[model samples]
Target: MQKNSSSIKSSTDILKQAIQFIGQHNITAIPINYTVSYEYCRGHHVLLRQAIDQAIVNKQPITNEAIQGWFDAFLLGYDLSELNKSHLDLNNIVDQLASTTTQAEEDVNQYDTSLKECKDELNETLDTSSLSSIVSSLLTSTTAMQIAMEQMKQQITASQCEIASLQDRLALVTIEAVTDPLTGLANRKGLSMAINESLSTALQSKNYPCLLLLDIDYFKKINDSFGHLVGDKAIKILADTLKKQLKGKDTAARYGGEEFAILLPETDLQNAWKVGENIRRVVESLRITRSNNHEEVFRMTISIGIARYQANQSINDLIELADNALYQSKNTGRNRVTIFETKL
Candidate 1:
């Protein structure tokens, strides 16, 4: 469909036809700048005139269908400038005129010379009834109507662009409200919301959700051994890696300094265990590098503890249970996944 389209070429033709078509209607006293005859086409004028002339050059016998096809073709082309709707409207008129003229030509085929003569009269206002009635009537009756519709279309297009721009702005606004800038993860506020929503849904559906609280083990030593810059990079890398592992519905957050959390909705103890193991394996496999005079690599892992919501427990109680399990993971070996064991 896009094969024959060239934006400039199509628009130029549409404008050419409009000027010629309008002149034939005798609706206006304006001069065509009718010089080299062909040269009227070469100059820059109102876009509608150009569009009409372009159709004429194709030399297809003007018929109603043919005229419609021409206008439809011109419309298929991209709008060159916002101000060109007038030109577009002009193109439409030319297409209509051409169609009517083709009908006139066929009816008066016996006057072969008359069709040629009418075509010329179409070039400018001359004494031809078909060209005058069919071509010119289209011009006089609908001038106000076409102008109004074109203006409305342009307004609609402008409004759509504004809507899209505002939507993008809104998304950025939303991100700033709930995201941790440094780690590109959810902030405390965002994480709290996730916990509440997850718990609420679980109570309604009776499907327990698991929360995993995670913290980097011996994170302070890296700050001491490498420097704060490397420490920050380590945090960012881990955040990015963990985020990649999480599903769209799951939440990963920079809960606080050197700490992160994941909220897994609709998940139970068994599923949470698999997710924890995957996180553990992925964290163990990271190869972080620091820029020294040459290069130095830094590596570490996370201690994660998973806790499932009890049927009647509060969201805060659920968070604390996960936190305690995370502490146990850190205390036992520093790099492992542990599930909270509630007091019987």
Candidate 2:
């Protein structure tokens, strides 16, 4: 009991320190669970600790973007461990079910053999004691068989319930796996999945898909000027703008840092360019105010690059083209959209 109490106190102390560390760095992304879990984790804990330390050493406020970058690099798929544990449990249940089935089969075979023996004994001799003994043996065998079957049925039902539970957990884990926790937009992995599905639909319908790459113009300046909290708000504002502009089948994802991506299904280059222009204009229209003073702080803008998918083209190739076009927008001027021109 004393040992357990000491361990709990130690864990509590570590969690408190972790929370203080997050506070010292001005990080809003560190959830309570993450802080608590970091107390127990080794590799990921060290990674995050080093990142926070570096930010402190550099006198940089730990922005959500920095945390997200670390997550993408060091902790991308760590959240799925629980899901994996669920799967392992499900496998174990299945194995138990199989074992129960084997036991039931053996019981059935034993009952069958006992019944045949009783029939043979009754036919050979009609003595009262022998007949009584055979009848008792038959009744015992039947009862044992029934019990085995009942146990097997119960095991199967329990296994089914457990499997259903694991599946639900897996679905949730899948969503969290591909989603960006901060902006509620899809992450890079989710973006890739969406793009691949869109490309497949395009191939089947002969309608080309389009990709748009967007970057928040002068985002670092925003962080330096206001603070990371306001910078987070600015990023969220852009995300909201992108979400509003997307169609039913369109996918918008955070493509790391100030970069975002959109996969538009069944769209050509011209329409995609127009969509990018709309997003650019809407973002430029946003005015963020300082929370403390209620004074208008600044407006935001984004640069976008648009490219239509070609037949037999890879997602990376499409993104590269769009990325180059996005740079064109950045080079010429901010708050504009550029279409990727195909090189002959």
lDDT of 1 by residue, 82-173 (tens): 22343343344444444445544454453455445546767776557766574555454345445544655565565455445434433454
Ten contiguous residues with the weakest lDDT in model 2: 35-44
Steric clash pairs (candidate 2): none
In candidate 2, what are the lDDT values of residues 215-267, reduced to their tens digit? 98899999999889999988888888888888799999999988999988998
154 Cα displacement, candidate 2 (Å): 5.8
Q: Which 10 residues in a row give candidate 1 its minimum summed lDDT?
A: 29-38
How badly does each model clash, as a count of residue pairs?
22, 0
Which regions in candidate 2 have their CA more than 4 angstroms from the true location? Answer: 1-127, 150-154, 157-165, 290-295
Query: What's model 2's lDDT at 57?
Result: 88
Stretches of candidate 1 off by over 4 Å are 1-166, 291-294
